[model samples]
Target: MLPLSLLNTAKGHPILVELKTGAHCHPKSPTLCEYIDQRSTVDRVTYNGHLHSCDNWMNINLHEVICTSAGGDKFWRLAEVYIRGSTIKYLRLPDQIIDIVREDREFRERRETLSGNGTGRGGRGGGSGGRGGYNNNRGGRGGGGAPRGRGGFSKQQN
Candidate 1:
């Protein structure tokens, strides 16, 4: 879970909130906003690539987020906010952060499997590592960064 300080950065109108709940947290039930209003749950609000809630809506730029509120009334401070644009064209999350989160989730699944949490049946597909080997080889097939390493597209070898 993200820290409280990160949410403070989103203190204005037009905020994008990505409600990530824990294992006990219900994603099907009332949305985070609604949950907050109904049960006063702490919500993580992300805006402008920052994970923090602002004091007021007027403090930040309101014209950049695709805001959404689940519940009606709640004092849930921002926990994490990623601002893209008027609709968050693209959320620029650090690769390391994404990897860590994915790895943690994978670990939990492995633990469950080892503890016989499943019915001895084969589990779902594993290894969803995105763009992993792209950083290694600069050419061939998995070319991602570039060829010359000068920040430009490398010619693909047929």
Candidate 2:
């Protein structure tokens, strides 16, 4: 599973995002943190932390953040922090989130298997030109075994 996919599945969970702002160079600085939720979507992040909040709320850009910290470490607070996606070095998620994502993936796989469409193979079954199946009269195989090329290459008429 991809990192983003795992994050999606970890919605509503607490996450520690480490930014590439070069803050890690300082071993005593606090990073940014967020309580993952539905609003945790990228581009715009809604969170609560030490930063002052306007109207008891804060919205941050995902591309402005430099670094973030998670877990019991007080190096950082939950205040709203904005970090550029490119500046993000990595994200720390709870172990349970991994399990949750795994279960969800397995469930989807099972569902697709039960429906006979989980093989990832394109086209339909009965050989009727499924989704992206080729239907043109190429004369390859399937369909009507019409001759080979477009009109056999006649002897050039001499």
Q: Model 2 misses residue 46 by how many Å?
A: 17
Q: After superposition, how far is residue 80 of candidate 2 from its true place, in Å?
A: 2.0
Clashes of each: 27, 17
Ten-residue region with minimum lDDT total, candidate 1: 123-132
Q: How many backbone clashes does candidate 2 have?
A: 17
lDDT of each: 0.36, 0.41
Model 2 Cα lDDT, one tens digit per residue, 4-123: 666566555555555443332222222232332222333322222222211112122322223323333223332245434554565666888889889998998888667653244432
TM-score of each: 0.26, 0.45
**Stretches of candidate 2 exceeding 4 Å from the true structure:** 21-78, 118-158
Cα distance off (Å), candidate 1, residue 102: 2.0
- Model 1 has a clash total of 27
- For this target, which candidate reaches the highest TM-score against the unseen true structure? 2
